[model samples]
Target: MKKQIYIVGLILFGLLSCVQKHTKDKIESNQSRIFHYNNEPYLIKGICYHPVPKGSDQRSFETIDQDLELMVEAGINTIRVYEPIDDIDVLDKINSAGLKVIIGFGYNQNGNYDILSGSFIDYVKKYIDHPSILMWELGNEYNYHPEWFNDDITNWYKALNESAALIQEIDKKHKVTTAHGELPDALALKMTDRIDVWGLNIYRWDNPSELFEQWEKVSEKPMYLSEAGGDSYMTITKQGYEEGFNEKAQADANAKILESIFNNREVCSGVTMFSFTDGWWKAGDTDTQDIGGWAPNSSGVPYDGTPNEEFWGIVDIDRNKKETYVVIKNKYKQTLTEY
Candidate 1:
């Protein structure tokens, strides 16, 4: 009996060692402002995903199997979530499907493991060894909301840098990033020294080409388009495309946007289009699709100047592929071919 117990202990020790090595080997690094995975350049072919079903404001992975299948079909190698995944099984499923995740943490979520609560680090330490993790995203476009940070954006930046520093102290393997709205000013860049990568949620109409040179002048950290895409609904017919649930406008704008992104792979790492599916919960009633939701710097949102938040998904609520989905798949796959 004693011999058997010792053998079991040895087996357990070996399994733990393997987990540690696997986690360490998959570290993400920035070498001279270029993102590298396992020491090789990794251009992210990613999409923002938040599948909150109609009639519910809560995020869920109940349709994960189908979602993963569609994501794999689109040649998507990474997923950007607005919140940290609470389920290990979901992370395992995502890993098995050959996808990595950039997990975002909110500032405050009613004491449910948020930055303000200081419990966000708990989730970080728990998932530190998970192979599917690509980066820990601190916030999404929080710069636009200084009201939450005592009427000053600088305070938020300080907290962001501190959180990032803590994560680096705990997990030296993965990098930390934040989703800033558009290009960061010189001051914002200076304040976020601990950030490994910068994510820009840009919507400068269909042409974001000017941003590449602009970004190169400011910082040397890696950057990716954390959110860049158009919604399906056009409020007014301005650019030859008709208004009202126009998928063509979205597809066309996304095509141009993607072309610009891929064309400037030298400076920009890659893009994770605004979303994977439409959210019925954004504008009005959660049970029905709403037409009016707003986003900053979204005047370039195709024929319509307004962003109908419910229609931004590359896939509809039911998981039907929108025209933009094909546009993304082609561009993403072509990128794979080029590399």
Candidate 2:
């Protein structure tokens, strides 16, 4: 009867797995101008994740288990990735750990899988039923690059809107969003009517409160800060914070930034702060940590007022928690209880 026993065991395992499936929460943003998960008002306590190991330029999930443990510890509920994740096992691990993901697609990736090539929809259709998916984000601050779209940014917006509409048509369960630099202009908003939510990659010197007031005057659609936080390395000393890789600069700035975001919850959704771990590949050498890198509209980057791209992570290259990690954990945990 060994054959019979084996078949029974397989059935039992399948049943248990089905019972343990992660929450199949439907996400939407409506007239309320806030995200609702399972019809309950939801806030995205998220982090921008690109865990490229040292000595490499490619994103890797080899340390996903360790990464998830740290993410869970920080009370982060969502991971905002810059590219679609193709591996089913990685998505499974993230789902099993009780987390959600915002999959971002680029306008062009030299033909592989991007919106311009019409291949990004393939990823959407593939992962449409995956429980871990919170939203499908299109483009990351592409408005800053008109040159890429034949010297006309509206061309990019048209493509973005069209692609977003297609994804929504296919996956009615999830919202389609975009990470625009700063705030969208009247033309930008008009062109992107199909975009469900606006993700502003804002940097207003640790004080982004004013943007909410401006947004209220402009449009009522849901919005969130897709990238707002300081890097650890200071280009120059200002305020009372010292220069030279001071973790406190990042910590202090992020603390204030979080405060601004939460205080304006009525007009904005929660933030997916700058990042998870330091990306050594942003500048100079992939094998070493470099201090200098540039970003559009980054004159408001904390005390030093510079992007310092390589040092933006709340955790360092090895996944060691920085002072900012504790700040984020405390804020996110406290906010979770409130909701």
Candidate 3:
């Protein structure tokens, strides 16, 4: 009996050693590139969302799977989410669904933050082993804060470089990108080696053609519009006003921008619409025109709780496909086939 017990202990020790070695090998191989798909260099076609925020919606595994199925059915291969720490299990589900993830970090209440905090680097070390992650987003549109302009832009670059180096140290296979909130000047910064691509959130009012040209002149790396939209209220007259923009105008702008980007394929990688549904928006949300929040009137009231003009979803909050969905689908199909 004593001999048998000793033998069992020895076997258990060996198994634990193998597990530890496997984990160690993964970390040591960080300098090596392991993230690739389809045997060809692929660009992610994705959507942006805060689907599972802490203390808000705790998305069940089933909910995550269903959402991924919808994205895949929509021909989207990438899903960008903020706060990976909040919903790691959902992230695993996203990976299992064969979707590439652009995970975000460093969100503060003021919206001006940095990866220099090193908290983001620590988080990367934990799950850098996951094969589903295609890239690390230091933060979402953090550069657009006016505070960034106060300091030397080099500071931002240095922060990005350092954070990126740390991530590479843990997993060199993934790329690092910054999500710029419509600040074309941010693209002009000297951080090309630190960043692999430019992620822009372009609103309908911006001059897409001009911005594309400007980015092309500044950076050799590829660019992607992580957020673009025709808010329901986007209109030509509201072009300059904060709240006056109309959806039709936004849609028209989207087509033109997509056409320019697709035609000038050398500079742009791909474009993703801002959202799929009209979600929660607080009163006086000035950061963006809340076009996705309103819907046409079904009752005598001029407006109902139904999605109003500002709601830019390709589908209504109820999941009914909109006219914009057809347009986007047809355009994407044409572009894919042509390319």
Candidate 4:
């Protein structure tokens, strides 16, 4: 009798979970179908892309075309950028590339609220009508550096909220989101009214389901992994660059993250991997291989700074596809229903 009851309970729980997933899928699918760029739904596959040879505002039509060609091969549909672009032809190039953008307006704008607020509104007035835009990225990893900030954090929130509210008032055509370094930064701040979607640059090594469950408990707004997947290169002393692990490790780690997101599509609106190409210049002119600095916890590990930063790219500096590239390339080809 007890065995029969246990089986029944397990069946009931499975049924309830399926029903819940179906309801969430319905809601997300409906949203994906309308009011988005080109009348499609929220984009599921993307890459945190900056094809520039270096981290500069320098632009060239030839480089843009070459970079986008690789993206085409990878089957990614969207790209997220950090600066405020004023070049019409540059925007046109991105539009012509058959890709959409989530334009970022960073809050680290000299830490001046009045100046930042005014400039934020100005950017909205310029690109709000552009067809290439998908969403307004209001803040970029601003909440992670509290030590750098001497004032109350509420002031930061006030400015960020104002920027989001202004865009909603004037544009109302695009969605708004604030990118944080982690789930805690996103959860610590209050962003109830103005923001539409939540963006997290999450690097959590485990418990993805619990993290999303925690997020759902706190906010019902849609969210995505704005930046993820990095492989650490620990040297003999773990201090300098000597290739700790090969590209296979990065590929596998990212593949696992992609699979997890596919399974928990309810909490995951979309995802953008850390990079498309290796930023050879990230460490400086002299050092090309030591670009992995995004990893913070390095107690038992080798080296310290950012052992995972340089090699985060799916492709190398020259746009050659890595193993991780092949995995995500195949995954990006699938649609929302298929995934």
Cα lDDT of all candidates, in order?
0.88, 0.89, 0.57, 0.67
TM-score of each: 0.89, 0.90, 0.67, 0.78
Q: List the candidates ranked by TM-score, beginning with the highest.
A: 2, 1, 4, 3
Report RMSD (Å) for each prediction in the order shown: 13.5, 12.6, 17.3, 7.2
Runs off by more than 4 Å, candidate 3: 1-39, 52-62, 85-88, 107-116, 148-154, 183-188, 204-207, 234-251, 284-310, 337-339
Model 1 score (lDDT) = 0.88
Candidate 3 per-residue lDDT over residues 1-339, each given as its tens digit = 999999999999999999986654222211112123334445456666543222233322334555676676677777676656445787677778877777777644233233645677666776777767777887666664537545565566666667777777767667777777664564445564766666777653423667767765665665777776555443223334234423454455556656765554445566666666544342125334343433222111111212343365565544556665565666665555122
For model 1, name the residue pairs that clash.
205-300
Candidate 4 lDDT by residue in tens digits, 24-90: 5453433431224444446557888765565443433346777788888888877887766667887
lDDT of 2 by residue, 247-338 (tens): 99899999999988887777778999999999999999999999899899888889798889999999999989999999999989876323
Query: Candidate 3, after superposition: displacement of residue 68 in Å?
Result: 2.3
Error of 3 at 122 (Å): 2.7
Q: What is the lDDT of residue 64 in candidate 1?
A: 98
Off by over 4 Å in 4: 1-40, 52-62, 110-117, 184-192, 232-245, 291-307, 335-339
**Model 1 lDDT per residue over 1-339, tens place:** 999999999999999999986664342433566776666678888999998988999999999999999999999999999988989999999999999999999998886768888788999989999999999999889999999999999999999999999999999889999999988988788898999989999988898999988988888778889999889988888789887889899999999999998777767888889899999999999999989987766776665778888999999999999999999999898774222
> Deviation in angstroms for 65 in model 1?
0.3
